[model samples]
Target: MAQAITAERGQWYKRLDLDENFEVVAIDRDEECIEIQYYSGEIEEIDEASWELLEIAPIAPPDNWSGAFGSDNRVEFEAQADSLETALNMVDNSN
Candidate 1:
């Protein structure tokens, strides 16, 4: 089974098609460099001075539990995603 990204840091959303194989794309931002894994994964490099650890929930299917306390839980569900590359390409070619 595919793994859900447990954290947001080092992780970014890409709309690349998940069904196809493609070369990795490199992106540079300030002093950080990131590798687009299409729809698979991402690689990011951050300065040690700026690195911080944050707790993140792992991706999981919905449990259908509902209540006052469960309201926030339902919000954490993730939906299906298209290829990250396709989405980025659309933005790049847009006028």
Candidate 2:
């Protein structure tokens, strides 16, 4: 059965029974087709008949201890800053 879907611009969706995620880049309601961009930078048009509305779970930021660093090394920099702050605080307390 074709799932009933309402495509909205800038919404993320996943294919039924698939792990890949896509964002709705455009919608042509008059033609009943939606343009989607994949996580891999691939873009394609899918007829409304082939897709359904997907409920995506909210993603949480990585905890400080987690090793999942971003491309800019933000996590490592934050860790170093925190350590330096702690050491400076200890020195200040000892004085």
Candidate 3:
């Protein structure tokens, strides 16, 4: 059976088409807005119409929820990614 999609706060979802993941961070009924935080730490507020159009399905929490540091540390995280590659290269050269 296909599981129904619910917009409850803190729920994680995988956008099937984009192959991306995000979480429901907030919902304001008065404003008819839903705030979501992507795994990459991008925040977006969507209205009911937009939310209905999203082709998403509920999913387990990501193994690594680095969205905690969020977009604020995006540059720093990106730098660390480069450092990770450099470390891998060093390991390869040591072989």
Candidate 4:
């Protein structure tokens, strides 16, 4: 059976079970900091200095990408930009 996120007033934690054998705790936090529990039963407190890592976007290329065109249909590339404005510029400059 899969474990679902059933919110409780004082739960203040999120967990995930993998392979029906091990579990992964995604977020276990209180008022001050967060804690993580691994499958090996090792518990570690996430450092405040590295908290910014959670806010970072995980993407090799951003979603705002403009497709590239070539004389050959099979030869094509994509222009991935950090912002919509930049993606528009990449597509509009083809002319």
Return the candidate ranking by TM-score, descending.
Answer: 3, 2, 4, 1
Compose the digit string of candidate 1's lDDT tens values, residues 1-53.
23243223223333223332222234455655434332222333433233223
How accurate locally is residue 44 in candidate 2, as Cα lDDT from 0 to 100?
83
In model 2, which range of ten residues has the least summed lDDT? 61-70
Where model 2 places Cα greater than 4 Å from the true spot, the runs are 1-3, 52-95
Residues 1-95 of candidate 2 have per-residue lDDT tens digits of: 44465666645556644576666666788998888766556788977766554443322222332222222544445555555334334434545
Where is the poorest 10-residue window by lDDT in model 3?
A: 83-92
Candidate 2 residue-wise lDDT at 27: 78
Which is better, 1 or 2, measured by TM-score? 2
Specify the poorest-scoring 10-residue window by lDDT in model 4: 16-25
Best by lDDT: 3
Rank order (by lDDT, best first)? 3, 2, 4, 1
The models' CA-based lDDT, in order, is 0.32, 0.54, 0.70, 0.32
**Pairs of colliding residues, candidate 2:** none
lDDT of 3 by residue, 1-95 (tens): 33446697767898887898987777899999998888887888999668888889998876555454344644555455544334334434546
Query: What are the clashing pairs of model 4?
Result: none
- lDDT of predicted model 4: 0.32
What TM-score would every model get versus the actual structure? 0.23, 0.48, 0.64, 0.23
Q: Which runs of model 4 end up more than 4 angstroms from their true locations? A: 1-31, 54-95
Q: Each candidate's root-mean-square deviation in Å? A: 13.8, 13.9, 11.9, 17.0
Model 3 scores a C-alpha lDDT of 0.70
